[model samples]
Target: MSWIYLDNNATTKMASEVLDAMLPFLQESYGNASSVQHRIGREANQAVALAREQIAQKLHVKESEIFFNSGATEGINTVLRGIAHAYARKGKHIITCQTEHKAVLSTCAQLERTGVEITYLPVNKTGEIALQMLRDSIRPDTILVCIMAANNESGIIHPISAIAEICQEKDVLFFCDATQLVGKQEIDLQRIPIDILTFSAHKFHGPTGVGVLYVRRKRKPIQIPPLISGGQQENGFRGGTLNVAPIVGCGKALIMTNLHPEIEQYRDELEKQIKLQIPEIMIHGEHAQRLSNTSFIAFRHIKAAEIMTALPHIALSSGSACTSGLLDPSHVLKAMAVSDDDAFASVRFSLSKFTTKAEVEETINDLAKAVSRLRSSSPAWQLFKDGLIS
Candidate 1:
């Protein structure tokens, strides 16, 4: 069986070079970074410092701005909850989009229980939030505006810079969940003025459980309380014995992937071929600026689960890994106003720099065969063909 992986948005395989970079740190150089007096600890601290600089360089931010954490979930909590507590005296309201990842949405939910007001901005059919609506949502008491740089499911990019401009004018803190956008898109902290950002290493080709939060040090000077308590690590922001291997792997992965060229060509070709082979399938986020490696599709009357179950060789998903197991369709597609039936019919196929054209062609053939076989047996599909379904 030929196995094809098109689920890079969920996670990616760690590159060989990244693994090589981490091996030494995991074994010979293992030491508590907080212990600067010992040589081993000094070397570990140096490795951690280099990782921070590497991540910061990729984002075009200062080294001090990047804080290593567990992953985007913890980063999201650290920023949202941290800000809610830090700025409670000033305001209690926060604004975010409805289609945000569970990390952001759940954190906001927790804040709401504590009397913090949260406004979830809705999106249009194309999964892009309106800049005007965001401006209107701003209140005098709004403490933070949380939005992602790119959506995990559709890969559609939000107007983050525009959002930043709105927050700046309103004097509210802005935090961007850049988990999907970090390696796929270039983020210039010097130009855009984004106050904070979160990204995970596994989204690219790095080890999991390690991520970075980019916080502007000079201009905005965000000084939220530490999310955890222990001896000073991650510059006193996060307190844990550093996972040196994964952090070093993350740095190596970022540096390697940034130099790699765009994978948009393969993605575009896959969607084109899929459309030609399987008629009446709708692809979402076609008009918006999206990540180069994502293609989200909906077969008119065939459920995505049926197609997924029929094809075992290819690796893909119907939505975000966090919500895929739930009974309902993706909240992201629902937020875009896609019908429940159509939402269930949708699937997200994400590519990586390593995806080959041959694999894409094979996936197209498999999808076409699966869709044809399912539609032949589907009474609902037959009714839709006869104009019985609207």
Candidate 2:
């Protein structure tokens, strides 16, 4: 009746337990985690340490491997730049996908200015990367391979285990941008053979401005130099006062998580109902294994902005939240070889554990009505019916 939120991949509502866990640190126990002498500081430090262990347990990694940071953006840059800076003598070459979030693409671009030879692999129409393509891309000069565990826009899960195996064989460091899929999907680093991984707590049901960079150091400690240097924090890999509240919240969120098959059913039913009503629509990444709570849809001959405007009560986006302000077609769609007009016509509907069946049903009904109104008024739709633009 009031508002239906479907743009959860951008961020999720923090779980009640997560919020409850954070309150003590925010109010009464507000001592800085880095302070050494005071009891309050020691308590805060203990909480941070517990949170570190919780996160490590969730990922099947060592507590010492976890380094807290602002969010995935910082985590990604730290891994990318840290590898480049520390291992430049080994290789200046890094590999990633073309459809990566700008946090990665932009960082690689900046690295390019400094003589780094970056290789961006292309994905198929399903938004899935081929394993052999990745193998062929590697060379003796390649030091790092960066790929996402799942795509933020399309929700298509990449073959991370295979990618990591390739990296392990080649002795190249692998960095997985698990920002979109880390919590929703189970990732056991102990079995995957990935060297470095990044994720944000806000992507799950935790507060923003807190994230983890899981560096595999159980075999041999990684030698990445800290990006921010001043005080010795995060084992000197990241400096500055630790965020105790969000870290505790993130830890609580992770401990309270599970696989949601009901959410997947809701997403599928949402698509089925929408397609039955609006027959000409396309569902991107439908064939690939994807996140259960995501649906990226495109109504032929309709602009995504128009649909959002028509359904004001339903929250949505045309692409990743990082680039939602931009008016151009989605770069991820374009990279997957989707047409220019179709790319502009797409909208992303991301759900979460809190998303209910009632909300999804309402969204489906509202979306059909909105699409009908737009398709009737559009000159492009008229041209499409006339077979002028195919």
**Alpha-carbon RMSD to native, per candidate:** 1.3, 1.0
- For model 2, the superposed segments whose C-alpha errors exceed 4 Å read 218-220
Consecutive 10-residue window with the lowest summed lDDT within model 2: 218-227
C-alpha lDDT values of all predictions = 0.90, 0.91
Which lDDT tens digits does candidate 2 get at residues 128-205? 888998999998989899999888999999989999888889888899999998779888988999988999999889
lDDT winner: 2
Candidate 1 per-residue C-alpha lDDT over 86-133 given as tens digits, one digit per residue, 9 for 90 to 100: 999989999999999999998899999999999999999999999999
